[model samples]
Target: MAVRPPVSKSNVFLLMVTGEIESAEFPEYDGLYCNFSFFYGQDWTVLSNSSEGITQTSMRGSSPASNFVWNFPIDVTFKSTNPFGWPQIVVSVYGVNSLGRDEVRGYGSIHLPVTPGRHSLDIDMFVPEPASKLQKLVSWLIGPRPELVDPKFVARGEGREITRVSSQGFVRANVNIVMKDFSKQGYRNGTERFSNNSS
Candidate 1:
């Protein structure tokens, strides 16, 4: 009889994410819309190419009930050998101004939940402010607002310390996470660690 060889399994783990950008609360803004995109580390490979999307414009409702609803769907999968660089969703909110031009309202980002389950996130949003009084006056008069050259910068920590920003609003997200071969690689999910620490 010939001896059988043991098969080697791949170490790569898979993460599946499905969710929705439910709504937003921008108290000082109206006629709002949003743009969403993903940012991941080089170690991660997205199985699905649905990396970006734009939400339809929505106006805020009356006082005590001012929510801009998008209900935009988000579905993506990622494969990675390590968790050092988790995926993050970045959201940029904009509003139609009096001039009928889109002006950036806020920017926010949140890391995908590490546990394999449902997660609800409230992402606080902010907008860049003018550096000086002169710049503020010029922006108010010229019809352009201060905004990041690349909104993806919100997902990163570099060069953000010098940027001045003000709280604009918050976005709500509901995500369902599924993982395969995650624990087989001897990795502890976030929930597991949380429980362990609480004990």
Candidate 2:
């Protein structure tokens, strides 16, 4: 018998970002709210904008710490390709202002699951800290410290941090990822079957 190539299993990719974000730089000591946006790079489109379209947290007053809890779940699909090559989830954090425009505090990214299963990552939010004039002058004369920027925070096609004259602030949080395999659904003579039948 002729040898046959094994079938590749198809998987549905789903990512969820659930965590608390602590603010340190913003002036609002109390009565602070935040919103988050998720981007998967140019190649992919974000499905269903997670819960409530976008990740918007309720107004959380500052007490022990300036923190906001958010739940952002996204559904993504990719043609047969290596999961490792998929771009990381770009999470842009912003502070809601009352007068008008929202302020961009900082940004952070996390790697997706390499395999077809649930995965999780604990990542600290990175905010930029302003540098002194002398420090900037010296850096301009010489070179900047590579250690100041974390690779995870750098988005694809974006070279260097948003602000060159700044350092990173850390806010601890956990990121969870859950992958579903919808391809394994029962099939009968090319027709799909559902667990809960309407007819």
lDDT of 2: 0.42
Task: State the lDDT of candidate 2 residue by residue for 82-132, as single tens digits.
Answer: 233454655544554444444444555555544333444534345544357
In order of appearance, the predictions have TM-scores of 0.91, 0.47
Model 1 earns a TM-score of 0.91
| Residue pairs with backbone atoms closer than 3 Å in model 1 (clashes) | none
| lDDT to native, each model | 0.88, 0.42
lDDT of 1 by residue, 1-199 (tens): 9989989899888888898999999877788888999889999998875878999998787775779999999888899998887999999999988888889989999999888779999999999999999999999998688988999999999989999999988999899988887776778875555353221
> Where is model 1 more than 4 Å wrong at Cα?
1-5, 190-199
Which run of 10 residues does model 2 get worst, by summed lDDT? 190-199
lDDT at residue 86 of model 2 (Cα atoms):
54
Model 2 residue 197 distance off true place after TM-score fit, in angstroms: 26
Q: What is the lDDT of residue 13 in candidate 2?
A: 40
